[model samples]
Target: MNEDTYNEMNQLHESGGAVATVDQLIQTLRDDKNYDRLFDALLLKKRLEMGVPVVRPTSFDNLPEDRRAEFEEHYVNAAREIGSLHLEAGSIPRAWIYLRTIREPEPIVAAINALEISQDVDEELVDIALYQGVAPAKGLEMLLASHGTCNSITVLDQQFMQLEPQVRQECAALLAQTIYRDLTATIKYEVERKQGSAPTEETLRELITGREWLFAEDNYHIDVSHLHAVIRFCRSLDANRDEVRLATELTEYGAQLSPQYRYAGDPPFEDYYTAHHHFFNALTDTDRDAALDYFRDQLAGDAPDSDKQLTAYHLVDLLRRIDRTEDALDIAAKYLLSVEDQLEFSFAELCAETGRYDKLMEVSRAQHDPVGYAAALVEQARTP
Candidate 1:
C-alpha cells in the first residue's frame, strides 16, 4: 500500500505483463513482512501457472484426477519454501506451522537447537520446543535458565509420563545436576561462613561429611520439596551419568534430615531417601548385593496384595537393569505371570530377551496355552 511500491508494481505490470507482475507482488509482500498473504500469493501464482482453480478448494475430490498429484506436489513445495523463508526471517512459530503441515520436523528442531539461550530467551520458544515436543532438551534448558529449578521440576513432574523414556531420563538428569550444583554452592557457602572458611571440595559427600551441624536443630538448606521431587524424578535417569551420582548425594542429604523432614513414599520406597540411596548405589555398582537384599526383604514382610505386586515389579526391574536377567526372569516368572494387570515387564518378553525360549514353551505348556507354546516352540527352533 506504500506509494512507491504501488507505482513500481504498476510499472512492472505495464512493462512485463502478468507473471512478472505477480513475481514482483510476492517480493513486495515479503518486503512488507506480510507472510500470511505471501503464502497465499505463492499458492495462487502456482495454481495460475498450472491452470488449476484460482480459488482454493476444500477437498481434493473436487480437483480433476489428472491435476491432483501436480497440485499436491506444488502445495508441498510451496509450503517448504514458505516455511524456509519464515525460518530465515527468525519466526520459529510461523515456520513450525508450515513445517508441521508438511511433516518436516527436523528443520524446526534444528532451528530451535541453534538458538543461543544464555539470555533474552523467549517463552514462546520454550512452549513449542518443549511442550510441542519439537526439541525438548532445548526447551527444558530455556525453562531452567529463565525460571529456575522449581519450575523445571514442576514441568518434569507434570509432563513426565507424556515424554518418551529417553527424553524423560535426559530432563530428569538435567534437573538432578542443576539441583546438585546449586546445593553444593549453598552448602559450601554455609560451611565457609560457619568455620570462618573451608577447603574447596568437589562432591556433596565431601562437603557434608564432617559437618553434622549442617543438619543440627532440624535445620536444612534449599527447598526440601524441590529436593524430594527431583530425587523422585531421578528414578527415570540412567545410573551411569554423573547426574545420577549427584542424585545419590541428594538422597544422602535426605537421609541426614530430621525425622520431620525425612518423609515416607509409596510402596517399596516407604523409607524414601534410604531406599533411593540403596537403589542408586545398586545401579552404580556400589554394594549391589546389599541393595538387592534390602529390596527383596521388603517382599518378605506382610503387605496388601497390590503393594506386594508392585514391590516385586520394582525388584525385578532393578535386577534386570543390573544385568541379572536370569534372576529377574526367575522372580518375574514366579510372581508377575498371573497378575492379570497390564504391566511394563512382560514374562514372555523377558524370557525371549534372555534367549530362554525353552522356558517360554515350558511355562506355556504348564498353563495349557497352546498358542503360547506354539509360538515359543517356533522361536526355540529358530534359535541357533
Candidate 2:
C-alpha cells in the first residue's frame, strides 16, 4: 500500500481494528520477503504490548524436525531483532524481552533469575505435560550435571553474586551451585558484597594473597610464585622498557591493574603517564601515593634480594630514583657474591646500568673479596 493507505490502516488498527491491520500486515509481509527485519520485529512488539498473539505461520511441533528447526530459527531471528529495538529505544519491557529472546531453558532461568522479577513464571506455561511438568526441570537438572561447560552457569553466578545474600541463597538452592572456598570465587563474592560488582586490582590484592591470586586456568591448582615475583618487579620501577612490556602482557591476559607506576619503555617521563594513556584515564596524586606505598611494602616483604631474581634488581633502579646510591651499592655487592654464571652476568650489568660506578670498580680491584681476575672481566663489560 501507498503512504495514505498505510496511515489509514494504522489509524483503524489503533481504534479497535486490530484484526484488519493484522490481515493487511500479513499480506504486506507475504509479498516482501526482504523488507527490514526491524519493521516486523516492531510490529510483533506492538502486538505483544497489546496482549495480542500473532497466528503462527507454521505449527511448530507438527512440522518435521528439519522444518521445526526453520520455525525455531525464525522465532530466534525475530526475537533478536525485537531485542535490538528494545535496547535502542531504552523503553522496551525487560520481562517481555526475556520471554521473547531466551530459547533454551537454562538461559531463560538465568535471565529471569537475574531480573528477580518474582512473577509466577509457572502460569505462563503452555505445554502442560512437557514444558510445565518435565522439560524445564529436566533442562535445569542437565545443566547442573555439566556445570563446568555451561555458559549460562557462568552468567548466573556473575548475576547471582550481585543480589542480596538471602536472594542469592534461594536461587543457589534451586540451581545446586554454590560459591565455594576457591579464592577467585571468594574474591568475587566478597567484592559483590562490598561494592555490588567485581573487585578491582588493588582491592583484590588487599583481600587475596600473592599465592591465592596465582590460579591456573585449567587446573585451578598450581603455585605460580615465579609469576608473582615477575609482577612485583614491574611494580617497583620508576620507568623502564621491560616494565612496560610486562604490564602490556599482563593486561592482554586480563590480569589486574594497580596504582603503581607504569613504564612507557622510552625514558623522559612523568610517573603513571603510560597507564593513563592506555589502561585508564588520568591518575590522581592519591592513586600514585597508594601504588608507591604498596610497591615498597611488597619489596620489603616479598621481593628477593638475590641474582636469580633479576627483576628484584630493579630495586637498585628504584633506589637510584630516590638518591639512595650507597644502599644501591650495598645491594649490588650482595648480589655479586650471591649467584653463579648467567645471574652473576645480569647482576653485574644491573650494577653498571643503575650507576653504582665506585662499587663496580671496588669489585674489580685487586683488594676485591674474590680473586681480581674474575672481577676484572665484569668491570671490562661494565666500562664504555
Candidate 3:
C-alpha cells in the first residue's frame, strides 16, 4: 500500500466505525510483498479482534512441555511485534491489546508506552498485568518510573486490594522503599489538594485516620514521616478545635499501629487518655457521661501519680459537666491539691463554678496566675 492509503487504512482501523474499509485494507495489506505493511495489517486485525471474546486455547496448556513453551514463545514474539508497530504509531490502546496477549509482558515497557499515549491506557495496562499475577511491586515500580499520575497510583491501589494476602504483603514491602518516593509524593499531594481550602476538623480527622495509602499494610514502616507531616499540617491550621480533633485521630491511629509497628512512638497511656478526655470534653454533654466513666476507670486503676492527676482534672471537668458542682469542687480539693499547679486551670474553673472565690484566689495566687487571681477577685466581689 502507498503512504496515503496506508495512513487512511490505519485511521479507519483505529476509528473502529469503518469495519468494511478496515477489512478491505487488511486483505490488501496481506497480499502486499512488503513485510512492514503486512505486519501493520496483522496488528489492525488483532486490534479489531480484541473485544471479541475467544475461548482461551485450552489445548495449549495441556500440550507437551516443549511444545507449550514453543507455543507461548510464538505468541509472545508476535505480540511484541504487533505492539511495537502500534506503539510507534502512537496508538496505545491497540498497542496495549498486543501487549496484553503476551502471558508475561514487560510491565515497564508496556506502562511507559501506554503512559506516553494516555493515562487511561497506562492505568488499564497496569491493572491487567497486576490481575494476571504480575507482582504489584514490580508493576508499581515500573508505572511510577514512568512518572505515573495521581490516577495511575489510584489504579495501583485498587489492584493492590485484589491481590492475595502474601502477594499484597510482598508488594507493600516493596513500595515502602525510596524508589517509589515519586509515586508516594504524588499521592500525598493529591490527598492534600483534595482537602481544599479551609478543610474542616472532620476532613482533617479523616485524612489522618485512614489506612488507605500511607498506612497500607506494607506502608506502615514509611508511615511515620507521613504521620508527622499530617500532624504538622493540622497544627499549621492554628485552630484549636481542629488541632484537638486531629490529635484525637492521631491518638487512635497510633493506638491501632502500636500492636504491629514500633515506629509509632510510644506516648504514655495517660497522653492518649488525656487526648480522648479533651476531645470528648470539646463535644456536647452527650459524651460527658462516657468521658466521666473513662476518667473514673483511669483513676481506679493502678495509674502513676501523673496519670492520676490528669485523670483527676478530667473527672473534675466531667463532674461539673453532670451539674455536680459541689462534687467537682470536693474532688479538686481532695485529689488535685498536691498537683495544684499542674491542674491549676481545672481547679480554678471548679472553684469559680462552685462559687468558691476564696479558694480560687488562694490557688491562683500560689500558681502565680495574675489573670486567674484577678478573675477570682472579681468573682469574690460579685458573690453575695
The deviation in Å at residue 29 for candidate 1 is: 3.3
Which residue pairs in candidate 2 collide? Answer: none
Q: Which run of 10 residues does model 1 get worst, by summed lDDT?
A: 54-63
TM-score of each: 0.90, 0.23, 0.32
Candidate 3 global CA lDDT score:
0.52
TM-score of 1: 0.90
The true-structure Cα RMSD of candidate 3 reads 24.7
Tens-place lDDT per residue, model 2, 86-198, is 43444224324433444433433443334322223333321221133223333333343343224324434444434444443333333322212233355556555756776
283 in model 2: Cα distance from truth in Å?
16
The lDDT for every candidate, in the order shown, is 0.84, 0.41, 0.52
Query: Predictions ranked by TM-score, top down?
Result: 1, 3, 2
Where does model 1 exceed 4 Å of error? 1-20, 30-34, 57-61, 339-341
User: Clash number for every model?
Assistant: 0, 0, 0
The model with the greater TM-score, 1 or 2, is: 1
Residue 307 C-alpha lDDT in model 3: 66
